[model samples]
Target: MHQQAKLFSLTDKHEQDAILQALSHFVSLRSLADENFECTWHDTFDWRLFAAKQQLTSRPHHQGYVATLIEKGKKVEQASVSGIFPSFANRLPAVSLAEKVQKHTKNRALLPMLTLEGTVRRWEIVDESGQPALELQVLQLTAESARTEQHTSLNTLLQLLPLKKRSNDFSQNFFTIVNGLQSTKSLPVDGLFATGAAATGLVPGDYQPWQPSGLDPQVPATKAIKDMIDHCLSVMQRNQQGIEEMLDVEFLHDYRIALRRIRALMKNFAPWFGSGGQKLEGELQWLGRRTGLVRDMDVFLEKLDILQATLPKELQEKLMPVKVHLWQRRDRGYAMLRRLFSSHRYRNLTAILTDCRLPEQREGDAEPVSIGQAATDTIDTAWQRLRKKGRRLSSRSADRDIHALRIAVKKYRYLVEHLRNLFPREFANLKRFKKIQNSLGRFNDASVQAQALEEMTRRLARSNDPSLLGTFQAIGYIQASLHQQQDEYRQQFFQQWKQLAQHMKRA
Candidate 1:
């Protein structure tokens, strides 16, 4: 694909004219066309397309609207159709692109983010020998908010489109000419879409979670813990809408991850959070349980096709009923989750978490604790606990025992990640912990899948479906396969745990 770059900082018309004049000194320039048009930018409610660095736009065409998908500032795909505003799944040219977008959007509907009516003044550039070189277009956009009817004119955008094959000589000449006219630096805004969104009084990445900055090792433990919780709460709030709307699976995934981190923070540093910590911990646990079923179903549905591919054709055909049952369960689970999010209890929980005050001290709270010291103590304790648990696990250990080891590893890994900035060298053990975590994680997944299949078999039998018999056999085969893989993973887990233990000791 050809490279197309947009410059959105060129606001001065005289400067633009000067740049074009400077370009004419090096190469032949011809004005192509100057026209005005309006286009609406569309994205899911959570801005999925924008998040993926893609833009979906629909503009008036000959007798209808032409929808195009622009990726990384280049028009990668387009389709012409007749509709006031057609769905992306219908207007996209390729099936794969449509499917990809549909998967990202899941059950959410697309909405227009902003509308831009702009005038484009275009010019064609060529070499002295009349060989086509590049196309330069200057666009002046007036963006209007679709929600509030607010209108604002954005900065003029200068776009460079290479007409023919680009070479080093051409690039050097192009930049040399432009660079000589003005000290052209990178644009402040990401692109036209971002500019339009900004002009409409919307921040493109405002909802993105931010990491803690300016942390000091000498900061008090209580202060550090509060900061961490506040950061996680921000992430949770940002993902709340996406999760409630079921815009995409990632929304729920990120929300769960952030929630998990918050729970871990409270558990590991309970003394720092003071007496109210226990109640908050309970509330977090309740929230986690509320969202668990939907996350589990999402995981199962994500791997359904891969699991189906493992079976023979006859067995695969019989697995259709299983897939259907899982999808139905997922839909129900999502609906339940939606209602829970909209509940008064959920709102109360968020309000409490957001406004809760940190305690000055408690009966067992640590006094004069430096953040660095607390982090080290926590990491050491978690590592020792994980090592103690892992040392007891073997191939002959019970499934629950191995699962316990997985949790320990997860806790230790989280500690290392959250406090890695404090101790860079010790945090290098993160790689070792990851190796052990992956092995145990895969084994745990197999165990869970086997149990879920068994439950599905029971449900099918109770329902008395005609395909129950074949489905049961297929489930049995899959469960057996999973058990075998779990056995192999169990062996790998022990070996990795041994290496990790040794690495931790040295560190």
Candidate 2:
């Protein structure tokens, strides 16, 4: 658990020789055996390890090969086998490593991300007692892209590893030597990873959504709306590949969220975009419906265990058929979703969105206003709408009313989130808003689950299966439990609403 410091230098043969020559002036430096090998970094096709800031590399070691997992530039885990390095399938169990890496990778096939062939020059720095105090490794890397077969220099990685007892002394000596050389630049822990990715023309984590910064409050309303739309569209575009490949559930979740936000923007700012707004709104709604089934199934499947655990053993056994049915439906839904994403309509919509531009003005357009004024006005309107809807709900209010309130809260939440950057200091009680939203969300989930149970019971009855009696009884019990839970949330809804209102008033 000793800290390792690394420095990166872009050096040619002459500079490399000069660095070694300068190191001779410091405490005695002894050259260790030089080693050369080809290294390849592997990860899931979704770049899971890279996204998590982890590195898995396989390189020649001793008479065999070693696979090392590095986290934050420190080697945390490693396993080596006494034979040639095999493919990922055979390598995992052969090395006797069976925990974190295995679980994270699961059954996903590992793909080589970056291939680097390099020579590593090792040196041992000794104290006055002629005892090894620190170790230095200089890696001269050349990265090649597996996709294009193009090559680029990844510069050099210079790492200094000090023994635990000599950390402070080594730190002082290391800085002294570095200061003396005055030619090398130190890099952050992940610097080498970024450098390697860049050299191979692969940008890691490039698909992350954009967060707005430095937004001008006095900007035009149309310009502001365009910025918000563009940001949401970018998020959708970023998750497109993940959705198509079905790499993970998050892709569809994020894609749907982005589209929902876009729809919200279009609704709230309809007057700002002229007639184009209506068309964009329709397209966004279409996209949302297309992805809705898969998202709903994903949520239910994720919580299926918890739902089943609420029932007795016999009941649980009867519910297994429903679970199987849900899974089959989800599979079919995902297949359809994949096809939809690959369809011409999706592509054309994406292209149109990418090239979208707000019109200068139209007959029904709102009078030009500053973004700050619009944001303040919108927030006020949304808050008032939510408050009005929430206040109308009583203990005996219909489920539809509660559902309407949930939608209101969602709209207000999205508005605040998207525009919070412009007025950061004003919304000091965002947590209160979030609490109210969550309470309403739970209430809605209870309502939806009850309806789902009813529908499932009817479907099972129509099939006339032998387990129909047990399943029906189980569904009724679950529906009753959900209704009781819903009542609990219902009772707390007013208090939550009041707290949110008080906070908004103060703000």
Candidate 3:
């Protein structure tokens, strides 16, 4: 058996030193153990991955080719008849499996290289694109022969990769990051939710899918939706003063996120509100679209510098005033947003969110499970599944596993937060999980951002202000700070996971 975790970050030429330093720290930490570690760098058009694999020398390198040749999107499963099939006769089988099993599956064009959640897995590509794109996934696995951290520690560290999006723009794809850990058997929702939560910060939206419709009074999820709406309303009531102090743009964005979650919950589950739900969802949609002006301006400003850099020297000089004009327009839009939020119509909308209620569907015959327990079970089960597949996972397999685990942890976190009192024991652990998840997420975001920044730098090399160089410098500084923080948090999260496991054991 093997146990593993992963860390993701964006590529930056300026922050190259900092990133390498962080990787050095990770390597040093792993070096304390007797197991020899393998470090490799994978670069592609879309992403760059610096991976650390444990006990790679013990395993045989992959040699046999498996192809699910696709002609115009239709899969052809004949291995011998495939023109693209690589010669397997001269190469050795990289795996050791039951002889009977291997013999039975030999004729199958792509034999199962591994299995994850009963899904047959192989390293061969299902299809190929004309573009030069590569997706690299890494799993930090510890074999049975090597000394490894406990499962809790491993998971805590795993959580870091998804959250690193907060501090930087590089590693923003929470879904992709989670998918990379397919071997870890993480909860199905862990990766999905992690991605969603990360997206909420940048985009401020709802939890896309709202399942288990029509309501079951005894279902914890049904109650969770109700409780969450109530909590959002209560939060608004109590924090309205503080909320008013922040930029209306940010407050409204946050409010919209909560409202959408509420709307999605009601829409997904029971029609307890019947006509009222349609009304509420309509209002929520109105709020979301209205707030779009603010968010759009913000996103635009964030990219303005990049756009400026991409212009020609003459165009750059001419665009300086245009930039100021756009900035003024954005500022006016923000002011309008402030007034809109303060209006009677907006207040009424918010008031509805606070006052909305979910009546018990069947007179509440049985008690629903606490939100915390549901989160725990889901996350734990997902992690277990990811761990079981760790040893034999390929790049694609690891991506799917990690993504599923991230989703599991994310949904669980949302639930635990919804009913904090129900699972007091796990409350602290959930907090730790959130922290680590955010760390890894930022790292990944930074990776992508770095790529964007590099492209922009080239495009802007001949442009004005030379002060834009300061922007790149700022980017580098943020990149370094995020890298340092992520490295420390990864270590800390691993430790927290051990404590969380103990708490779970006692429970």
> Could you list the CA RMSD of all candidates, in the order they appear?
5.5, 5.6, 26.9
Q: What is the TM-score of each candidate against the true structure?
A: 0.77, 0.77, 0.33
Per-residue lDDT for 1-507 in model 3, tens only?
111123332222244234334433322211111222221111111111101110001111234223222222222231322232222211223232212222332211121111111111111111122221122232232212101111110121122222222323222332343434323233322232222223233111222222222333345554666666775555444334323443223344445545545554454343456667787778777866766555555544555566556554444554454346447766776667668768998899877766666654424436445434444554455445433443333333433343344434454555444445554655556766676456434434333344444555565565766756655554444445445654564455445445655655576
TM-score of candidate 2 versus the correct structure, residues matched by position? 0.77
Residue pairs of candidate 2 with colliding backbone atoms: none
For model 3, the superposed segments whose C-alpha errors exceed 4 Å read 1-228, 237-359, 362-410, 444-507
Q: Quote the positional error of residue 159 for candidate 3 in Å.
A: 58
User: Total clashing residue pairs per candidate?
Assistant: 0, 0, 66
What's the TM for model 3? 0.33
In model 1, what lDDT does residue 461 have? 89
For candidate 1, write residues 1-507 as lDDT tens digits. 443453545746557777677667777788897988698887775667777887778899888877777776667677776656654364455576567666666644667778989899988877656777777788888998764467998776776667765543674567555644553444532466667776778765455443444569898777777787788888887777767767567678778878878887876777766777788888888999878778877787766778788988888888888889888988898888889888998899888777776655435555667788778878777767777887787679999999888877776676666787886776776787788888987898788788888888887788877747778878887888888989899999888877767766775
Q: Which sequence of candidate numbers ranks them by lDDT, best first?
A: 1, 2, 3
Worst 10 residues of 1 by lDDT: 180-189
